[model samples]
Target: MRRKKLFKMAEVLTFENVFRDPTVIFGKWKEFFGNDNDIVLEVGCGRGEYVIGLSEVYPERNFVGLEMKGSRIWPGAKKMLAEERKNVSFINTMVKNVFDFFGEGELSEIWVTFPDPQPKPCRAMKRLISPRHLEMYKKLLKKGGKLHFKTDNTMLFDYGVEVVGADKDFEVEVVEYDLYSTEDRADLAEAKLVQTYYEGKFSALGEKIKYLRAKI
Candidate 1:
């Protein structure tokens, strides 16, 4: 029998209602989290592959997947709920307003996976891991916390590395040009993070997966 895809529908509040309005989440972080535990936040968590997988692998650490589209996020949210995963949660919110959802130094780790490349020069600001966004990530991540990134776009991969290198607060520890090579595949299997829908498709197409791990 084929293995079941672990996904479920999720009910989420509006972005403005949850993060912007003080009545919703303000002073209620503990209630949302339910305990004092190390937290990892995954931005642009499409279809919830990586965050859900990581939550299963690391039950002691809480995982929060933030995405703007409720329709795209519901499956992952439902999966976590169906699995009865207490350490995982989902947030439907825009990346531009991430600061509203998280206070300074509030996260143990941050993951940016397969974000839009935004090839046009005019659309450069929209790149998820741009210098401006990296600065914002630095504010929310704890000192020495890790930032993990994976992308199939070569230009975006190079740009991310350049941006991270220019930031004094971040130090790049791992840069893999091809993450799906046989050797690398074996390494990754030992501690598999999570694979998004796009990641699986791209890998099937033989597209190289670039990865970077950095400390802030």
Candidate 2:
């Protein structure tokens, strides 16, 4: 575990990666990934297993996982480094600082998985899928880009859908309240389900997974 912590500390990226001026490097992702390709973000990417899985599946698209906790960011960063996957990277920063790093319409897609619901109404702003965060996502994603959300909490899923539906700019493209019980959702099952370790744990307990896709 000590060795693992050491490695995570080494891989965690900060302002220096973008020359300490995130706003200046906006829309210039090729400088970091070494190629001009679609960029995708996984917000609140705990353990980062799902985003790492996506980097493996979509070699042509660059994937960046934003995680504040170095310990949780370790496994995915270490694995990508060992595999020499240039398309994958991890950013150690707060989600609120996201705009400081990326520019408008710079990202192709975003994935929000198992984020804390911040159940209390007063703390709801802390939720990653809150209305504020959705607006932030709107500016980053390219036209028609999609935002995918998955969670085991029923309350969080319902809240996210309600927020998306109320927003005039976003359209709820898909909804799957019980993923396992649903049938023939090849669109979700085939590629969108980037199941992570946490997901497996919840599934083992027979929890039903909920999902929603919002088009921006």
Candidate 3:
């Protein structure tokens, strides 16, 4: 497994659209994509499912997947390179360093898909939707930009909703404990459109996906 991971890491380094240096593209995302289109970010994008899927759906917009593990990002990065996708890219970095990856008000949307719950009380601040991360999102995302969260863990969902709801800077737009159970509508189309690898596994095991969207 270690050898396979090393190979994937090496292969990811060769992809033209995969970036290792966040400083290089800090405020030049439009120049990198060669367009002034709006950019969206997907945090913890395993295998780039959401990024690839959203790119196909919204070709007019650019999508960037941020994941620290290159092995998990190999399949998606390879597909984007093979297909010559211009609006999709991958960033090899941790979420904690996201503030340095993009300029202020640079992103139009942000997605936190099936992230680790960090359930313990001591680890609560580590969750992607924690108060500290929300502040970072507020700084990087444009005014009124949306932040979407999806997970199979109830505790995390409730915690996220509470935190975002309490923040005066954010307005909670949507909160669904069971995404698919509700009536299908245009507002929920994006979240309904893509199912990440872990999302599929959790759904198969009878877990109801929890989703929340907030505008900052």
Candidate 4:
């Protein structure tokens, strides 16, 4: 099993849609995707469930999955290749280096689905929704762009709402402590369009999904 995974990890970068060299596509995303369509990013996209789903739902918009683990990227890259999805791409890198691959206001939307939450106090800054990360996201997002955050962690959810709501630069458009509690609305429809791998596990364990939508 380990050998198979290692082989897949090594093969991840070989896919036509997977890019490890930021210089090759940085500031040339439209050329990379061969279209001027808006680009959306899914941070820490494990196995590429959300990105893949969104790509199917919104074919007009390009989708990129940013995940650090090459092994974690293997399955998604392989599946996308098999399906011949032209609008999807994968970047194997940490979120801190996002600027290396994208220019300011380059992305139309961003998604943070089931991130680690960086629960430790000392690792607070490591959280995807942390203030520093929010700044990075704000810079990368185009004017009128939006970011969607979904998680099952109560503490992280509250922290995101508090910090994002308090920030004067951003507007917290919607906050749902239990996303599945009601029928999906047009405002937050994408959050329920697909179930991510971890989201499925948490939902099966009777955990209520928390969702936050903020405009930058």
CA lDDT of every candidate: 0.77, 0.80, 0.93, 0.91
TM-score versus the correct structure, for each prediction? 0.86, 0.88, 0.97, 0.97
Off by over 4 Å in 2: 1-7, 10-27, 190-192
lDDT string for model 3 (1-216, tens) is 689899999899788899888778788888899999999999999899999999998999999999999988999999998899999999998988887788789999999999899989999998989999999999989988999999999999999999999999999999999999989799999999999999999999999999999998
Q: Model 4: which residue pairs collide?
A: none
Pairs that clash in candidate 3: none
lDDT of 4 by residue, 153-186 (tens): 9999998998788877788898999998967588
How accurate locally is residue 156 in candidate 2, as Cα lDDT from 0 to 100? 89
TM-score of predicted structure 1: 0.86
Query: Which whole-number lDDT from 0 to 100 does residue 12 have in model 3?
Result: 96
Give the winner by TM-score. Answer: 3
TM-score of 2: 0.88
Which pairs clash in the backbone of model 1?
8-78, 8-79
Model 1: per-residue Cα lDDT over 1-216, one tens digit each: 222322222234432212334356645667776888888988998887887888787788888788877667766666666667777777777887777677889899998999989998788788989988998899999998989889989999999999998899999987889875636454355223566898888888989988888998
Model 1 residue 11 CA deviation (Å) reads 4.6
